[model samples]
Target: MKAQLIEGGSFQDSRGSISFVNDFCFKDIVRFYILENSEENKIRAWQGHKLDCKNFYCLVGSFRVSYVKIDNWDKPSKALKVESVILRASKSQILSIPAGYANAIESLEANSKLISFSTLPLDEVKDDDVRYNKDMWLLQ
Candidate 1:
């Protein structure tokens, strides 16, 4: 499956605001973690899964999320096209990344926090995890 954004919205009426992604389902999510980048412009790059899916949501500040479809599991092409999107706390949305793609995240602001939802359990993550250098694919 291709990566897509699950759009969401918020409601406000003097009692503050409520943000939600109604289209995001939790049935396949077996694990989750909050990723906080201490410094701005720092990149966490080139991590992927072959059998697991991931969903990312910006909880605080802003981020640039980039991904590339893997051409080969053992050795992906360095020239693969990279796609990216900006996720901000002001906008409530979830970026769903399916299997077979490598992804990187960069914080646009200091102390940016993102929540990642995964389809695989903690025990199976190690075996399915794949990593590459931060410079594997340039993000635009």
Candidate 2:
């Protein structure tokens, strides 16, 4: 199991690596992940948000993830450098993101499938989740 510190902090993910928090029961909080592994296992990058902390796990494929933290709302930029990690489906690996972090994912293979878990139910919002092309940078 490989782990890294979240940007701007020294805290480390020392607990179970492939685990999800079972808090805030998810009867409908959009436990889904966007797919982009269409051609040559290429997935366009995109920005996504979660109502609560989220867990991303690949059940049957491989992919890369770049995690970012937008701390400045005024200037509004990504904190630190983009941390990239490869997630594979053959292994039970889960990436956990606390609420309020901007993150992007790309599929390394065409058959890549990612399963994301959220603390909020799926039906709690009129627009539960928004998808932006990986190229669209100036997202607030």
Candidate 3:
């Protein structure tokens, strides 16, 4: 699995400053997800889609987007490489993850949020999602 970062930035005007970001291109965006992690509610990990590659962007605050390649599913102890990206609203970066990869999200701030852009629709994503334990890939 490979991860690509999309460039993003902010701008200002006479009235007030504004921010904007673009991926250059995102084809067939079928779904959007807004993930929030807070003290009352915590998330170690979530579902990983088999049919869709997701693009992650931190709308506010900061968090860690972790991913692992699932090419070798038979051998759980095969020592697959785990990759991570720190997403922050200040930096305004978008991370694109391809299919066949498992993802885990960790919130670094109190009220952190992540917006996910999916290639597949909700129905397909539900059927194709492969749920993995956070303990397996998440750092203790």
Supply the global lDDT for candidate 1.
0.93
Q: Compare the candidates by TM-score and give the number of the best one.
A: 1
Name the lDDT value of residue 87 in candidate 3. Answer: 89
Candidate 1 local lDDT, 16-82, one digit each (tens): 9999999999999998999987664489998988999989999999999999999898988899999
* Model 3 poorest ten-residue lDDT run: 71-80
**Candidate 2 lDDT, 1-140, residue by residue in tens:** 12232211122366624433333345644666645466753654545454556667776679787665545433444333456667776655567666555567777776777777676665663343445446546322
Clashes of 3: 0
Better candidate by lDDT, 2 or 3: 3
Please provide, for model 3 over 90-121, each residue's C-alpha lDDT reduced to its tens digit, 9 standing for 90 to 100: 88788898887878888888888889888898
Better of 2 and 3 by TM-score: 3
After superposing candidate 2, which stretches have Cα over 4 Å from the reference? 1-36, 73-75, 78-80, 125-133, 136-140
Task: Give the top-scoring candidate (lDDT).
Answer: 1
TM-score of each: 0.96, 0.60, 0.87
- In Å, residue 72's CA in model 1 sits off its true spot by 0.3
RMSD of 1: 1.1
Number of colliding residue pairs in model 2: 7
